[model samples]
Each structure stands twice: as structure tokens, then as C-alpha cells.
Target: MSQPSQRPEFPVHLLSSPAMIEACRERDFARIFTLARRAGMHNSLIARLCDMTASRVGEVISGTRQLRDMAVIERVSDGLRIPGHMLGLARRDWESASADPTAPTVDIAPAASGLVPTLPGADLDSILAVAAGPKLSPSTVRALHSSIEDYWRRDDEHGGEVLRPAVVGQLRYVVDLIKETGEGEYRRNLYGVAAELARLTGWTYFDARQYSQARTYFTEALHLAKAVDDRPFMANVLACMSLQATYEERPADAVALSTAAQDCARRQGATPRVMSMLSMREAFAHASMSNRSAAHSALAEAHTCFERISDQDPDPAWVSYFDETKLIVDTGIARGRLGEAEAAEPLVEEALRREPRGNHRGRAFHSFWLARIQLQRGNLDQACDTAASSLELASVVESERVSGHLREFHQQLAPFRKEPAAVAFETQLRATLR
Candidate 1:
């Protein structure tokens, strides 16, 4: 329904006409009805809206009848959605119900079942179309979520470069499922599922070191998570973005992002494991900035969070990879970033021994750190051997990020290129690059 301020179909322009305004000011229904009829509203509809007979409205339009009753006038004001001052009456009840244009509108819509996911400033037809899709069964939704965990498992053993297409394909299909799940409890659940998949898509790109593409997906994941009010997942995406920033040598951005992630995790009562992971990110950010004391404090906080972990905690599937071994290795990575390889090397070595052989990609990643630490400790021969072994472990993986670490380690070998160990490692590195 158009407002009184609008045009011909709504008749606001007619009210603005000098002749019509004069008729309204004098309470002349005969002339007012004549103006209304000329603007396309018929006598029959006007009669029904104004609670009068068709003959009565026709007589008024024909200047043969007059309206003097206040109740009839009020009905005319309301039925046409007119503001009351235009009709020489007090403001009506419906006019008072209009939304304030100055108020900020969030994109979120309240769920009759669960929140209806919407893009910002979405048009009416698209929102209405949300209710038009197929109603999915519980089993189908379960399978879609299950596929997400399966992708994570595969992404652990193999690098994400080869698996990115499949992961993105799954993400698109989940979004399609979200669209199909119109007015059910499954709608919110599907958005939650899509949120995690979007986060994983970002993770795959992050592993490939495609930072811009990675951030785009990370933002999408955050938007999806926010749509369902999934605070834990929102924190997860922020943490991943923080890690990417750390890689890009943007410590201030990394610190800001990780701090935000920590805030979300703690506020949401996320499990101890989640808190631990977020703390680790903060430590990494601090280490990158060479804030050694703050880095150690964050690491201590991470250890405390780890100590609080309980079997009863409702940890999400995404945090399943952040076990004690991973925590230890992450601590080493953070320590090494602050030039503490003497302290970092043992923790990484222990994690390597404890971690499973099936986690070749993770082990390969940690192995590069081990080689870097060995070089920092001036054990060039051991560094060369460790670097070569890391390459062999990662041979089946396609991670650019892991290769990035190897390259960084290789640069430190420039001063030692004439050494037999360096010559041998260079030969091995060439074969691996090939």
C-alpha cells in the first residue's frame, strides 16, 4: 500500500492540487470525490472503503451528495492510508504505525522458526522468495554437514590446492541447500553448516597463500555465521584472518583481528579448546611484532586455556584439530618468530614425534619450522637433513604455504652455499621443486 505522500494510484498528488486542497479545507466531499474519481479509484471501491453506498459515492462525485459525518471521513482517511492533516482530521492510528526512516535497520530478520538469512538491503521479492524453496529432510541436511568434516579430514593429510575446487563446490551446494530450506528450523541449521564450509573454503585458500581470495571467503564466512548469530564460528573466521595477517607481516592487523576473535570466543562461552586456539593466534601476532613479554603472556594464557579443556565441553568439529600436540607445535612457531629457536626447537620436535603419520601435511609444516630452528641454532648439517626430510614428507601435498616456509629456510642457507651440506640440500631442493 502506497503512503499518502505518493502519486495517482495513491492520490497524494491530487491532494496537492490547489483545487483539491481548497475542497479539503472547506470539508467539501463533493469536489474531493470528484478529484479522487479522476485519479483512477472507482466509485464502487471508494464506496466500500468509505463505508457508503455506490450510489452515495456516485452522487458525491456527481456533486449531488455531501459528506458531513466524522466517522465516514475517518474511514476515508484510513482506507486510502492518508495522513490525517491532509483530510482535516486528527492523525489516525494507522499513520502512527509507520516505521521511522531514521532508525538503523539490521540485515537480520527474526525467525518465526529460526532467523531468516538475508543480505543487507535485500529487495522484497528476494525475501519473499525465501519461502518458495523446497523443504529439505533432516537426513539431507545431516549429510551436507557430515561432508564438511570429511573435507577437513582430507585437507589435513593432503594440501588444499588440489582440494580447493571440491571444497568450493561443496560450499556452493550448501548455499543452495540454505536457499532451499525456506521456513523451517533447518534454515538456520543450514546457514550454520554453510558458515563452516565458507570458513573452510577460506582456510584452503589461506593454505595456498592466496591472501586476497582467502580474505574474501573469510568475510563471506563471517557474514554467514552472523546471519545465524553463530558467535563461535564468527570467532573462528576472525582467528583464521588473524593468522593470514600474521603471514603477510601485518602484525598490527593481526593483533587487532586476534583480539577481536578472543573477545568473541570468551563472550560466547566457547569451549576451552576454542579459547586456547584464539590465545595461540594472539601469541603469534605479538611474536610477529617482537613484543616478547606480551607474546609469552599470550602463550601462557593459551596453556591455561588448554588446561581448562574438559570432555564435557561442547567443542565444535572445526576445533577438533587443535589438540595438545598442535598446541605445542604452535607455541614453537610463535617462539621461533621472536628469535627463541633454542626454546622452540624441542617443543616442535616433541610434537613431530607425537603427531600421527597420517597427518603428513601438518607434519611437513612443522618439519620446516624444525629445520629453520636447527639453522638458527647453527647446526647447518642437521638443518639441511631436516629440510630435505620435510620436502619428502610434503612431496604428496600441494600447499604453497608449506613451500613458502621451505623457501624462507632456504634463504638462510645463502652464506653457507659453499658448504657440502648446503650443496647437497640445494641439489635435493631442485629435485623437489621440479
Candidate 2:
């Protein structure tokens, strides 16, 4: 692909209104066709853009082809004039149906479940209709990007539920925009964001014990990272995949993925922060595989990496959380897993103190790790107390990994089966398990 043009600047914040959506949805096909012609897109080029045969495009426009293929439907949506977001929704619905025809299809309800104003359903439809029909305007592209960034920043926590259908809807819209615009740099930036969202989705599904769904999301994320040629981001995907594997008790597989991630980071000259994060992941895999020596070695490397980080380009998105305090917490978890209660507790406690205020998620995870240490030290009461607090935080985040950590804690408490607290915690944890 040629270098992308300096994109026309538009105020991102103004794009969230319903009016634009409605305008795009009501876009005219003749106008869209004219726009395409003006852009010098021949029938063959349009066919390629839609991933269809040239004859098929002609047949669809001429009302000969039924456009049974949802892919083609999206292409037509693209060929006509639909807003990118609406086209995305339509395509997602179509794809989901194709995957499982029996699955229930939900209507497009684009409420601003995020920080941005929600576009009306009609407006959203019109915008997508126009985007699909004609070449998109620079303004529309900027709007989609803004909406996605808003979605990225949204935080909806409801007693363990993150009702984020609206955010997902916007992300799909951004994905469609990326595909249609063929803007490599923009697409690359978006892919990183997409991978994080996909990982978050996978983690949520994993918490629900929907292993199949979680794995699917993770796999798709890996594909997206590859598309953007983001090796470190891909490593993050692999590391998260290893976490899933570890939870599934597939220690060997987890170890392999962890190793692969570490190697990829090294080969790519990943930042110290990124490499440290990967090293911590490797340590977890080693602990899972019962290789205490390897786990300790990985932990040491992670610490060394933390010390070596220097001025460089920004860290990869996924590894942003791997600071000194977090690394210490992770190392403590690794030690606890290796049955070093005495060694792990102090480190964990110190790490806990360093955890930044207001990070409820991190605090919850730290509590879980503390619970693990308590359990290993044979302090069932303390462990149960910590577990309860962890559960309270886990309840807010909709994270499967958090739930899995709690599940492991619950399993450890089983030896105290006759104890009331142990029984109660186990029951509560099991109820949430898939």
C-alpha cells in the first residue's frame, strides 16, 4: 500500500451526534455510485473492494443477484451509502447468523452506553446505509475514530457486569471503517485498540467459564495483531492465551506459548516494560508446569528488566500495567504458587502497599494473591477474609481471570471443608463458575 495522505483534520468530539448517523443512513445510492465513479473505482475495483467477482457486483446493482452472501451484503452496504457503524452492525448480525443460523438475532439499538452521546437508531442506520453505498467522507472517518476512542475510555461497572454492548457496537463500526478506508496507519493504531478490547472480551467470557468463546476472541485478536504487524502486541495476545491455557490446566501448552512470547519480544527488541511483562507471564507458565527453578529465573529476569527500562518509544498498550509494584505482586504470586509461603507473603504485602490508590481492579488482584499466600501459610481465616475482599472487587470488573484466581483460592480452602467460611466462599465461587 502507498503512504496514506495527511488525513483532513476534523473535530472528533462533534461526531457523536445522532444527526450525522441519520444523514448517512438516508444516503442515496445514485449519489454513492457517482461518488465511487468520481473516485475512479471501476466495477472490477469495486468487486475487489467487496471481495466479490466483478460480475457479481454488476448483478447486484442490476437487481439480478440476490446478494445472499452477508459478505456481499456488507459490500453492497459499502457500495451504497450506509454509515460505517450501521454497516458494521449489519455485517456482524449477518456473520453471527452465518456462524449459527439458530442463534437469536438482536435488533440494532445504538444507545450511548459510553461517554459519547448515543446516536438514534434511525440515524445510525442511515449513516451505515450511506457509508456502505458510497465512498465515505473524511468527516465520517474522523467521527468513527472519535466514537471508538470514547468507547475505549468508557467504564460501566454494575455489581460485576460491564454492560458494554454499545462499546462493542462502536468498535465494530471502527473495524468496518478501517477495512473500507484502506488507511494503513489508522488501521494499525485501531488494531492495537481492537486487540485490547478483544482480550478484555475474552477475559470476560473466561470469567463466565465460556472457554470456547474466550478462546475464539483471543484467536481473533492474534489475527488482528498479525494484520497490523505488531509483534509485541501479538506477544501480549499469546501471553493472554497462555493464561487461558493455564486456567484450563494445560500447563505444557501454556509454557510453550509463554516461551514463544518471550522469544518474540527478544527478537523484536521490545521495550524493557514490555519484555518484563512477558517475563512475568513466562514465570506464571513455569509455575503452572511445576518448574520452580525456571519460574524463579523468569521472575529474576523480569525484575532486571524493570531496572533496565530507559527512555524509548511508548510501551505497548497491553503491557502498560507492568510497573515495578505490579511485577513484585506477580513475582509474589509465582512464589506462592511454588509453595514458598514465607518468601511470598512479605513480598506480596510490600507490593500491595505500592499498588496505586483507586485501582480497584489491581487492589482486588493483590488481595487474591494475598489470599493465596495465606492459604499456603495455613492461615485459613486470613485467606478467607482476603478471598472475600477479592471477590468483592472481582464482582465489579467482569474479569474471568479474576474469577479463576478466586476459584483457585476456593479450591485451596476446600481442605477446610468443615469450616463455615470455607464452605460459604466455595459455594459462592462455584455459583459463578461456568
Candidate maximizing TM-score? 1
For model 2, the superposed segments whose C-alpha errors exceed 4 Å read: 1-102, 106-164, 419-434
* Tens digits of per-residue lDDT for model 1, 13-98: 66567897687777777777777777787888777777788898888777776554344666676665555556644334454323
Error in Å for residue 119 of model 2: 23
* Cα TM-score per model: 0.69, 0.63
- lDDT, residue 138, candidate 2: 54
RMSD of each: 23.4, 17.6
Writing each residue's lDDT as its tens digit, candidate 2 over 1-434 gives 89987522112222233543443354333333334545556677666655677786566556564432223444554443332343322223123323323223434333222211222121122223335443455565566545544433333233112523544444455454455455556546666666655665555445444455457667767766776677887888888888878877898998899889888777778898988888888899999888999999999988998898876757764565667788888888899889888999988899878876556666777899898888878888788888888887776665555666787677677668889879877776656543
* Prediction 2 TM-score vs. true: 0.63
**Model 1 accuracy (lDDT, Cα):** 0.77
Write down the lDDT of every candidate, Cα atoms only: 0.77, 0.63
Q: Clashing residue pairs in candidate 1, if any? A: none
